[model samples]
Target: MAPTVLRLLLMLLALLPTIGLGNNAAIADTDSTPAELTIANRSIFTFHATFLGETPAARAQRATAVIEEALRGTDELKVSIDPLQNSYLVLLGNRRAFIVSPQDLEVSGGDTRVAAEQAAAVLRQVVDESGEARNLHFLLKAFGLSALATLIFLVLIKGAHLARRKLRGRLPQLMRERARQIRVGQMPLFDMQFVYRIIDRLLSLFYWVVVLLLGYQWLSFVLSQFPYTRPWGESLNVHLLDLLRYLLDGILQAIPGIAVAILIFFIARGISGFSRRVLERMARPGTLNWLTEETLQPTVRLTSLAIWLFALVMAYPYLPGSGTDAFKGLSVLLGLMISLGASSMVGQAAAGLILTYSRTLKTGEYVRVGDNEGTVTEVGMFNTTIRTGLGEVLTLPNSMITGSVTRNYSRAVQGRGYIVDTVVTIGYDTPWRQVEAMLVAAAQRTEGILDTPKPQVFQTGLSDFYPEYRLVAQAVPSEPRPRAELLSLLHANIQDVFNEYGVQIMSPHYLGDPAQEKWVPQDKWYTAPAKGQSADEP
Candidate 1:
């Protein structure tokens, strides 16, 4: 045997119950700190105190050598103990094996001689077993028993495979017959193949776990049949039981805490449902004007999220493993990750909430922000989607919207319509009254332009050359395509009116006076492309 194995064996024996003689093995040791004397890997007795300054372990080692030599001889082993001053001598046949001091004896009234006799009795029993283990008949019987156990183990392993095959054959059909589609409404969450793979993996894992347990039992049983390996076999059984008990107890102890945490979450869910219904009722038109069907959605989600988060805090102590360092570390890691990454996301969400609650923006309203002008298609928490009449879609971040100048054209209108305005810089020669009247006439002639409020013209700026005239009008038909069409018709009418009135609409950006005038006559108004071909594709 390896020296490491021998040392481990000796250390392991120290942890086991000390062997006295017969019933005395159970006797409580008060004064003795004994060292074990093992034969054939089986512990027979113990020695206490050093003989001639030798330690208890050294004396036990010497005694074990003496006992082993006696067993090697042809004569049967004879054990006896002789009393002496302050100690007793354990004798193997006529040879002195070792001495036992008061340290090896129980504190009871029994003398050292009586203790030595008990020790002799236990040694006799152990020596007889060791001798029998070496006998041919005994060895043959042990080999047969081991062979029988091996055969049973092999048969069982084969049977397990057969059972596994039988299970595999029927399991798929059984699972299919009992399977229910996991879906939300008409949509299947996943395909059947995904479920099958998961089942197959679980089945294979269970099969291997059972096979390993069976192998452990078989090996332990085979080891237990021989005297030399019996301690190993017994240790396996004891440790396995201990491990299982620990796991079972831990699970049992954790159940109540887990149940409490689960119960808290269920209660929170109930509260959430109730709060949602209450919030929905509170979001009616008269209840909270800002919380419309569209705007109320964010509030509902936030309320639910807040409730769940609060519930988590309340139930954290009751959660299994919550007190463990690993769970605390995981929570801190998640918090750090969120704090590091969510700066922009949080700003966007806050802006969205402000936009919704303050009624600053609404879906389907025409708005111009920065250089992008379109109808708001969706006002989401992080981004707003706008679809332009020019066939371009814009996804603007909420934070960007909050930071830039915004012009809402549809908010002040009574119905589904948007404001339309066009700027014209006519020469100083054209009268401001004529310019305003002509612009109003153009707007009145255009289709879809609302007339109830009447269009207005503003001389917004008086530049060095001419005045900048802006014609502002309201147009019905909130749809984006109609707005573009109405603006086109208005521009066409303005050109026709200016031509019919014999007034040349000239840009006032010239550095010098023109020779005559920069005017496109009525004949060329519908230039080759304006009538059919693309005038200028955007």
Candidate 2:
């Protein structure tokens, strides 16, 4: 393995549980100290002995000094197990000794006397192991063992890789066949290749995991070979355990909130579904007289959105990290952006709502707004679409529509057939009654004119050269004829009727009357393309 990878493995191994030597690995010279003391980087104990009113820390220092002195001198070090006292003493020559307390050996899983013997044994081993000669020997032994462990780790990794390569070549066909067996409505629920690819990835992950574990075990074992690195191995194990415990604790703490959020989501979804169904029923005719089927879906959708939003808001506090400043800041920023950018949208939406509730404009209604007149095809939240009389569709913003004057031809038809009117000029020499009768006769000949209301004629103005006569008549509302077609027919009928009567229809701007009178003679009325017989023929 690469050195970087090994270093990473060592770090990772630190998090594992320390397995060797158990909890009694560290020893204390006395029972009064919580602070553990170490000799040559090896944990001795959490034991502290107070002597001559000295603190445990001071006393531990003194014990360490005696041990160092014994090691320096030629005097042999001796560990005497004292069973009655439930402790062991390490003596230097005949004068100096340090007591190793029962609490120190208690971690080794033994009674006080047994612990005392264990402490004595460990002390003798430590004294012998502390010399330069033993250290060099230990260092060399550690390197050799580390090399062997590394070779074993490499072999294991190579095997795992070889196994993985073999599986990769063979597993795809097997995974694909398994995936093909699952189907829905004769369609494959999952792609065979996709399942195979996922299986391959999982296998690769498993191989990597095995390699990492092997590297970790090798690193831990190598560190334990030398006294200087033994404590590091122990700490690595402790820290790994601590990290796992922390992760488990965090997951446990978040479980209740996560569960609550999920429950809220499901409940909100159910409520939305139920409400939509109820609204649909209410939208049917006779169920709720005020609610129209057209408005039902939009209302349901808006209501559902509101319910979901409310549910999320209520559940937000229960979500992990919801109370964090970052989440709050993000929420505030989004709200601010919407408020700033949605002014026109809000106006349009509000206008749409107004249009809906006020019944100003509805689908299928023929209406004129400003210069654009058409049949309203749809009224949406932001815009209203109308197909014009000219076959052109115009999409106008709802806010703009709300601000304009709207004339509904359909509504006018509902009350009284919409009036179709035209104005004409005649010489003042023509009798007023005759002019009125002639204009009304022109309206009566129009195909779409409603006869029951009767056509009316009025002298709208007395111009400089003529009398302005206005003819008004209601068109049949149910008639499917266009306004232009109806007006064209009316104009043709008026011209024919005037020609048969020999009364010329002049304009107010005429400078003088023509030499032979501008009216067409009855014989010449159906000239050329005008093959229809004149009004006076029958």
Best by TM-score: 1
How would you encode candidate 1's per-residue C-alpha lDDT over 215-238 as one tens digit per residue?
A: 899889988877778778878998
User: How high a TM-score does candidate 2 get?
Assistant: 0.49
**Clash-forming residue pairs, model 1:** 32-103
Q: What does candidate 1 score on TM?
A: 0.68
- Give lDDT: candidate 1, residue 144: 97
Best by lDDT: 1
Q: Model 2, 233-340: lDDT tens per residue?
A: 777777778888999998998899999999999999999999999998888888876578667867887899999999999899889878889999999999999989
- Model 2 spans > 4 angstroms off: 1-141, 159-179, 190-214, 320-538
Q: lDDT per model, in order?
A: 0.79, 0.73
